[model samples]
Target chain A: MTVAAEKQPAVDRDVCIEVSNVTLRFGGVTSLADAGLSLRRGEVLAVIGPNGAGKTSLFNCLTGVYRPQEGNVLYRSRGGREVSLLDRKPHQICRLGVARTFQNIRLFAALTAFENVKIGAEIRQRTGPIGAMLGMPWVRRAERVSDEHAHDLLAFVGVQHRSNIIASALAYGEQRRLEIARALATDPEVLLLDEPAAGTNPAEKRDLESLINRINKELGVTVLLIEHDMRLVMSVAMNVVVLNFGRVIASGTPAEVQGDPAVVEAYLGTPADGGDGDAAPR
Target chain B: MTTLSAVARRARWWNHARVRRIGAYVFAGIVVALVTGPGGSEGHYSNGLRHGLLAPRVIPFIVGGLVVWAAVELGGRQLYRVRPLVTTVVSGSQRRWQSPVVRLVSYGLLLVVAIVYPMHISEFWRVVAANEIAIYVLLAIGLNVVIGFAGLLDLGYIAFFAIGAYATAYFTGRLPIHAPFTLNPFLVIPLAIGLALISGVILGFPTLRLRGDYLAIVTLGFGEIVYEFAKNQQGITTGSAGVFNIPHFSIHLLDINYDWGLPSLPYYYVSLGFIVVVMFLFSRLENSRVGRAWTAIREDEVAAAATGVATLKYKLMAFAIGASTSGLAGVLFASKVGSITPDAFTLQYSILVLVLVIFGGMGSIAGVALGAAVLTWLPELLRTHVNPQNRFIYFGMLIIIMMIFRPQGLLPSRRRAREIRFAEAGLEGADALGPTPGSGLTS
Candidate 1:
């Protein structure tokens, strides 16, 4: 892993998203205070912190759920256009090649697993409502393509066997993988996972780790995740950022951040009360 | 310590056989009194205690109450003993109906019945009664798209109906305000649809941002506003008197003239044709990308948005499409009546259509059609035989009983049935239900 990192020229690696001094507040309480980070193309980056750290808030701001009061979130489109992501809607961000999953699984509970993945491809569907209402051949062909693509994504995420099952009926680990498959169906250039390994056993976590690695390496999609699982963050992420309260405490390679004193203090200060079970000192 | 000793004494008293036996007799006596209370059947005929204990009504009620109480006590004991077996059998039967073939055959048989219905009926009933049922079915299906599929609880769906009716009035030169030229009612159908579509967008664009009950309140206000506008705009709508003598739906082509005149036959066929077309289009929309997007938004708007489903756009689309169906029905209504009135497009009409949708399964096309037909026909059937005051009471009781037993619907859409079952099973969120069949992209 270190050898590949050393071989890649720093100047050649493109930055996909740049968060510059972004500040977000909910009334008097500040959730993110002048926080900034950059996600490089085709790399796995993890944002790790204790409870109440602005990790999930940073993800929300990037996805346009909450607008930052100051600074900008800028994205480099595949066509090499610099697009400002501020004032844009969440779906607009998704259309511009950003996809995200919720911290708590938010699958379409009444829809089948196959249908859940198909909804992700809706952003890229060219057929309009009129064409669909008319049941035109072109619309049918597009639907067929979407169906096949959804199945492929399900298989890619290793949940194809549960395709016919309702999303809510799936095992917890399967729901997590299905959510990832649904996100992938959007053809996103950058994927954000909010606590993707949460509530999973050791075996499921190992499966998730390899899946994230495959998504990053084989598919060449950029990933930015908010995770409390240190094993996942240390093993999978090439870059890690540590947050405490509402600010970034340290940012570097996973090994470098792990060795930082601020990171240690954030995690080890009150393991019994403040730290999440997974993030506590082991 | 005194409170504890008091509780112990109460427990000992409750355990005594004579006290238990006396308690049962008192319970039976209270039930007897309740049975002959003021709200009872024969209470209306009697003043107070003037009727003797041996009076015909008094004796029957007293005896019947005791018998019912004893049966209930005996049955409760037996049912409690076999409740586990009963619960398993009920769940097992519910699972059996989940099979797709049973649903498919039932739907097919229903379709065949609907197609042959107008043919077997009398001319008067077919032209007047059946035509009305067909028109209401169209409205119910339209509202179902918004409330059922899109999960937008629209309470002002009748506003679209009013717009459609008024559009026909204006285009046919029936309104007092202004008319560029009179157009054939058939030709003006598209204009009426367009007007309703614009109104839907106007209502949806601003209010779609609000969710659940807030949206419902706004739509309710919107319906009232439309009604008031039609009732008060004397210069245009003629106020309560309404526009009159709207031309019959007709056509003159290739030296042949066809008029949907007073026989009501042509109007019946016309409404049926529209119903068939709308149902086909709706089912197609339900099984497509648009339908999936609507379902996603309904379940979780934030997740749907994050997944690239444009939430507002789909909501508005559902609103407009739902409005279009009501517009068509309104046009048919106008042509049939040869007049349009503000009274016809009341809030009651909106609520009636909503009831039909809920009575039938919301998301199921066949279910709404059945609901509309049954609701429309049942009232008409009761009108001649039953007392007018009692008819509404009976209808209310029936609806309450329906909701208690089958909250999902008579013929539930697969997803809705599972959702209701999950809720019944003490699940916290609707999202906890297992996999439902028939959520594919194809119909």
Candidate 2:
């Protein structure tokens, strides 16, 4: 059993994103305290926590949206450079092959879903304003590539039929899927999804679970997700980290952490505070 | 805390809401009366208060205010009732107008009218069209790039215009500090544009991150700084004595060597050519990936950044491009007018250009150009037939009515209309001008 557990992380693959000793604070509130997690290449890792447990904060830190006061986020680029993500801006971090979706949908509301996804796909394009203005053939080729990629991504996320719809006009579930499609457009080696299944119906949740599995298995992309849906998490996640009050309380295989006493105590509340039996993150 | 709480509790409503609303109209009347009334230059008071508070002038303002109130109160219900119908008809027509055949025909008609109308106008009106209207229209198109495409509020756009003018002057050896070698004003256009583009980047580096109001204030300051430099720097810009004898645009080609002399017709044709070229190029830019990045940045900066768009770089590019256009207009203006003063590039021109963009419909290139034409032409018409002194009062009223009725200008871009409608409808995005499926570059 010990040998199998030790060999679970394949020796050939490296960590895609490694967060270590990260601490984030907002004024007097310490949002994440000495919290850390590592996402191995081509695997699904879930960070499960109650409301305000700093799961989103951790995501922000990794994506360069929130610069932690201490600690480092190291990303291994496809070029094999172990680059530090701590000091870079969000766009620079994205270029280094890490993309993320927001907990609340942050799709470009005014743009069409196809345009929104194209925005991501076109990041790899080298066309300048002058080139675009002149309608150069090379620029056209770049645009066509991005357009084709946008089509494929929209299809992959099952929103190809609604690709022309304005992003804000999309149904909530479709918006969620569209957002995933947009993040994928950046062609990231690692995709960070913050509560992708938060408001989704059971059927949509099931769909998301399969999509996530496909993203990991077929596309060979690492995924780090923060979720509250135990069924979806257990079904898809290979590893789970439980956080409470900005601290990582337990981490292991989904089934192992499900039965851990510390994770249970954190979720159900402790004796010092009046215990809420099910402290769900909404 | 106790004092703050006490102050907060002192909620005062002196009259019923309706009475106060009417009274607000009355107050506007008094203010307009004081401003537009015959001044103390002709009156008894030394400081020129107008003494409108005591006379018939005050009565007119008060009457105007009451008229406004009547329109709001009486016309309010009718407006509310007709709004949906109006929106339906407007949107329906807007959709028809988007077809390729309709668009081509409309553009052709507009071009025909533009070319023919100038020939029939009086010489004075022709000069106004060539000089004032064309200049303002060019300035408006440049500003639309900043405020509409990039979503950056630039109140100091005229600063870039002034820079272009000064560059032309310097290049033509008209400034107090002469150029190393004189260049034809035609040849100086690119050089002046480059100068303005560079200045735009310099200004944007520190101020673009300020966002909205703060960004506006910073640009306003920059405009004032340039204006002051031109006005007071005797060694450089001749200290408001102005730069003169700046030669007009000419063609000194291999076979044709002709100076574009005093007649404004030549200037009009050349300026029209510039406008057409700019419109074509800008439309292409607006439909490109660069334009998409700008729209993305405007919609959600964080999302744009995380999606690998260099948001700041795209913003700077927009600012610089807009500035370059302003520079081009300045070069043309300087050469055609054969002179320029600091007074010509004041803060007033900046606000006027902004008004043109907003009145034209922010993002629509055709709309902005049309807006400039109409607004500038109306002033000339008023100067000829009506009292020009009170022209702004008419303008203020027109704007107020427009804002209350069709906030989307006389002509609006199809995409910009969607943006405004979505905002008003809480992001439902009931698309105006109908939907064009399979997006990306479709817009």
Candidate 3:
């Protein structure tokens, strides 16, 4: 058995999301091919790959933004009902408890921080049109509760002080944090973080790690992170999935994947003279 | 503990709510007494209110006006509550049943007052109030769809108004009919509407991709085009001479000949009915999935599409729906005026409608209605009591004042209110930019 499989024995059988034989073609280019990964509940799985490894495309397919010509993305809902993620709409996937943050923040800039978060909760809001229009008791109550919840979520991401600020006014780091909070407001079963630390400073990166850890441990939310920062991913993720040329080259513990010869070849393009630095940790 | 502070905070808001409720009751009581009590006398307030209710043309206006105010307030509150500038404290949990009930009761009261108003008012005052209100209501509703729901800034919507009026004239005027083209005046309404829809589609198709200021400019161009068309199309629209002595609409049967002659009170009722129907449909559409789609697109088109909302299709839908409403209003307007002229439709009318929607509350049915009534009546009231020569100045000043003091309008929807409040708060450092430094350059 693989080291990753051995380390996660209890959750090894608890695979809630499985991406198998997924191949994506963009005209003449192949974005992803035969890439397979399993995400279990209450686990943080990091997808680390080179620049052109099609990490974002994989995310898009998993979130139903794209349909791969040949692949099956099976997602097991909270109720243990298996469903195809590729068959659903993005909003439907969101409604089905799969929320994702974008690599480039996608916030409603004109809206206040509170409103930005509330929009994530809009799909789950129980009030009907008449209720919203008339400001009926039920709608009003729901809105108030949602507003408070949004505030709490913002606080969770350390942006509570900026609650009334317009989203566009926020700094880059704050905006990224706000996006995460907004995604969390949807109350997703699994949170997908796309390059959460891309433009963040070192201090902000540490905070992000703690935030993600807390969310996974305390909130009991599963996490699927796609990050380019190798050190951060190696430090936090329980299992690591590495991709090269849209295909999975290695899947195991961080240490095991780190030492793989294929991963070295994928990163350095087949090495220099006889693989002298093949096992180097750099 | 932290729980104690939370409870205390809740208690404070509860106290504020109590104070607000008491204040509302006191204010309502005082106003009611002032209007209905003996000391009020038969002066401006009494006359205005009575005239507003009694005139056949005015009754619809009164009902529509009140509805507009309520809608604006609701919309403004929602929109403003989210703004940083407005530290809004949400009070007692909203009671779902009370809102609809309150709206229904308010409308019913307005209708009742309208029906009984003429019994105690002067006929001339009544006629003036009624006529102004109905026309403005139609204009406001049409503009609301474009500016409010679609988030399109149209500086020349009045062109559609002109098109409908001219179409009516060409069909029903003394122009020579090549064949057996005699049709009922009521039928002309549908034809006018159809023509307006086609015009809207023609205009909207190319302009849908334009954003904000650019779109406004294009629409302004279209409005000018319509006006110019009416002025130059002498062979069809009688040019600047304009179509005159156009016959009032009538339905003739075997026994009853229902001729709605000149003063056009019956026509007011027809306009009222049409406004109500449109208002109902607008409200429904605003709350539907389509309405949500429009708002989503308005907020962020790229994000909306990422979420599976078809942006182009919905934007076009907004243009089509908004224009269609205006077309319906146009037909009513043409029928009521009983004439067609290029002078009737102008950029001024478009600006007036835009002002009404903005002053009332964008994307709010009731707010638009209120805006329509106020702007409509204000000019006429000025013409009668105030200086007629400086009426334009007064309106321009009013628009400026509304923008500065109550940008969300008298009865802004909650959402609009929140936006205005947010903008006012200078949340995004927008205020720091300080009064649009290059404003003159853009103008």
* Candidate 1 accuracy as lDDT: 0.82
Q: Which digits, one per residue and each the tens of the lDDT, describe model 2 over residues A164-256?
A: 998888999999999999999999999999999989999999899999999999888889988989988999999889999998888878877
Model 2 RMSD in Å is 7.2
Model 3 spans > 4 angstroms off: A1-100, A103-193, A196-282, B1-98, B118-131, B173-180, B253-256, B427-443
lDDT of 3 by residue, A107-197 (tens): 7665667767766655566555445545467766876787788888998999999998878778999999988887888888899999999
- Most lDDT-accurate candidate: 2
Q: Backbone clashes in each candidate structure, one number apiece?
A: 1, 0, 33
| lDDT agreement with native, every candidate | 0.82, 0.85, 0.72
Which residue runs of candidate 1 sit more than 4 Å off their true CA positions? A1-13, A270-282, B1-112, B119-124, B127-131, B425-443
How does residue B400 of candidate 1 score in lDDT? 86
lDDT of 3 by residue, B297-349 (tens): 56555455444445556677676666666766766666666666678788888
Candidate 2: residue B38 lDDT (0-100): 54
Docking class of 3: incorrect
